[model samples]
Target: MEKGQRMKIVTRTRAGTITGLMVVVLVLAGLALPAVAPRSLIQDLFFILTMLSLAQVWNLLAGYGGLVSVGQQAFVGIGAYAMFAMVILFGWDPVPAVLVGGVAAVILAVPTAFFAFRLQGAYFAIGTWVIAEVTRLLVAQWKALGGGTGTSLPREATSDIMGVELIRTLFDVREAAARDILAYWLALILTVCIIGGIYWLLKNRLGLALAAVRDNTEAARSVGIDTTRLKWAVFLIAAFATGLIGALIYVQTARISPDAAFSLTDWTAYVIFIVVIGGIGTLEGPIIGVIVFFVLQSALSDYGAWYLLTLGLLAIAVMLFAPKGLWGLIAARTGLRLFPVQRRLVGHDINGGK
Candidate 1:
């Protein structure tokens, strides 16, 4: 040991640096995909990117904030409906309406948190589900928005959305295909922002506080952490992001129905599956999980109920054999962390000697 030395906290690792470069390359490739890829493939990517965004938000809420909410469909539905309302009612363009959707979701989250935050553990989960159901029912009563049956976005709105013309001009594709490309690009951007933002957060002091709160609420509180505020912030942030994703999803589909918009199976359950199977607490887990999920869906979806059964069985097997998830298991065994969040202390002599 040296008498006079300096210590620095480092969170970067060799693997993470390489992974970051790889991610940049992949993103660039994704941006170029519409130029060469088929329309169906672009649509498939939109699905994957949206689902990944949802899974990441859910992971942030449940994995880091210690808030296990099963009713995230509420935000998705609200966000979609809000965007629909903007287009159908106020005649706003769908592109800007997507942002409104996020804002609307945040508005819903305020009251939702006020109620759901009072409950703990499973009760909190149930509370969220109940709220989502209630919201769905209320939205169904909005006859202006098609009541229970739902309505489709106006053709004019979809045909003339911002960026669609540019894409159509560049690719010489139809309006429908151009719209899909625009949506796909937005999804790609959203996914990257959410992942990058979460990683940055995980490397900061607030991330440490979040981990402490997730691990031991009482202990965190004992150490002067404001657990309530932290949870609130995480909840609202998740709601806004989920809402934005939701809105973007419907914009691409150009259709909105209460049942589909607020489907627990699509928005929440599938997301939970992705996070659980991939690794809930790690950023890399959702990336791995979504890929696995999409592969499984593509392969077994033709089997109807068997597809769900297979997913159920796989999830159960993973839970029993690898509770930490596939990524967690891999990281534990190989000591490989592509998204290193743990801070390490490095010491050097004040005179610059190592």
Candidate 2:
């Protein structure tokens, strides 16, 4: 103990520095993947990146904001539908229409939060799902978009998208394959932005307020934290991101349907599984979870019902044994944190006591 010593707050660790370097290298590789990788591989990566983005948003809602919404597919569906409307009705390009999807999701979130925020626990989850179902029913009635059966992006829309031509010429691939590459690149960029943004938020004051609210609402309120506002921010942000992801997904597929776009199993249930299996509260959880899920899906997809059963069993086993998730267990044992967000105070002396 020295009188001249002072304490400074820090959030970085050796592991985090190393992880950041590794992430940069990985992202660079991902950016160049279309040059050498097979089209199938690129498609698979698009799936992984989009799913990871969805899982992270869900984690932010349920894990950080204490808002467990099971109707997230509503945003995904609405976003996709909005993109479709832009392309089919107004002759807009699909690329820019994706932004409209995000805006649409935020629009949906306002009324959704107004209603669902009043409920608690399981009721909130159910209320969200109910709202999604209603949205789906309404979307199914839009005859211009093929009514209940859904519709495809016009041939011109898909063939003449913004960046597909550049990719086709540069990579010397067909229009379809070039579109895949473009979508894959966009997915990579979106994922990097979402993950980096969330990490940044977690290292800032808003993250502290979010954590306080999540841990104890009354306590955070006593300290003058506006809990409702925080929750709304988290909800709306998640909605916007999810919507963008949804629109991108449909752009890649060049098709949209009410049932498929709003599927609970695809958008919400699977995302919840990813977060729960990977570790809900940590940034690394979704990364680890999505990898595991993709592997399982690849191996067991042929088994149909058994595949789902195995996933359910595995999730239950993890809940019972790991509780905090696979990454949580690994972190507990190895103290590895690729994305460290917790603050620590360290002492240093004025006399250069390094």
Candidate 3:
């Protein structure tokens, strides 16, 4: 062996490379879906992307940050309302209004964290739920936004939305088709950004510190890691992202109401189900989880109670038998990763060494 042979540390594998390439192909294909897919199909994909984005954000906070929040619908509702208020009162365009939604969520999160952080475990979850309820009640009193009856995006508002005209001209489709396509693209971009941003964070020193904080808070503190600050950051960031997604969802629907916007089942419970059924910690988990969720909804949603029961049982089975999730199972068997963040060390054996 050579005396000065070199070694390499790689974070990605050959299989991971292939997996990544496949993902790129799929994303590119998805971008073109509006051209060939029906309006309903585009809407369906938009729903999946938006939900997946929410699940990914939740997983980052609870699965990785150890901040389990049961009232994420708070941010969603606030964000959606903020956008509605902007469009209705201020005449802001929907595209730029989403940013305001994110900012509003972050603002709401600050006070919320001050209260919720004082509690632990189940108490913290309850604290969040209470906060969400309070927010819903407050929003319900804002008569300008139709009080509780809700309101729809006026035809003029929807028609003049950013990129709608361009999309209509580009695709030679109706106004509704253009809107669906625009929403789908926005959802796709948001999901990719959330997953990519989280992956990048997890590959840095912050990831290691966050992991330590998650495993044992006191232990992390003993090593001088600011566990409290890290947790707060994760919570606020998740809230901000969730708010943006919520606003986008409402924009796509062109309708809003307090109950629907803040519904536990629609915004929080279903998101939790998606994250749990997907693998919790890994980025791929939510990706797989959302796919599974979509399939289940497509087939069993008509059954109502039976559909929910099946989902409940499926989550329980995953928890009991495959605690890591479907993605975890596949990864265990094939060692394939699309977003490989785990580090590995590889080196040649020294010449004539044992």
User: Per-prediction TM-score, please?
Assistant: 0.97, 0.97, 0.94
Off by over 4 Å in 2: 1-4, 349-354
What's model 1's TM-score? 0.97
lDDT scores in order = 0.94, 0.93, 0.89
Task: Score residue 239 of candidate 3 by CA lDDT.
Answer: 94
Q: Lowest summed lDDT over 10 consecutive residues: which window, candidate 3?
A: 345-354
Off by over 4 Å in 1: 1-5, 348-354
Give one digit per residue, the lDDT tens place, for model 3 in 275-331. Answer: 888898888899899999999988997788988888889999999999999988998
Query: Which is better, 1 or 3, measured by TM-score?
Result: 1
> For candidate 1, what is the lDDT?
0.94
- Quality of model 3 by C-alpha lDDT: 0.89
Give the clash count for model 3.
Answer: 0
RMSD of 3: 2.1
RMSD of each: 2.1, 2.0, 2.1
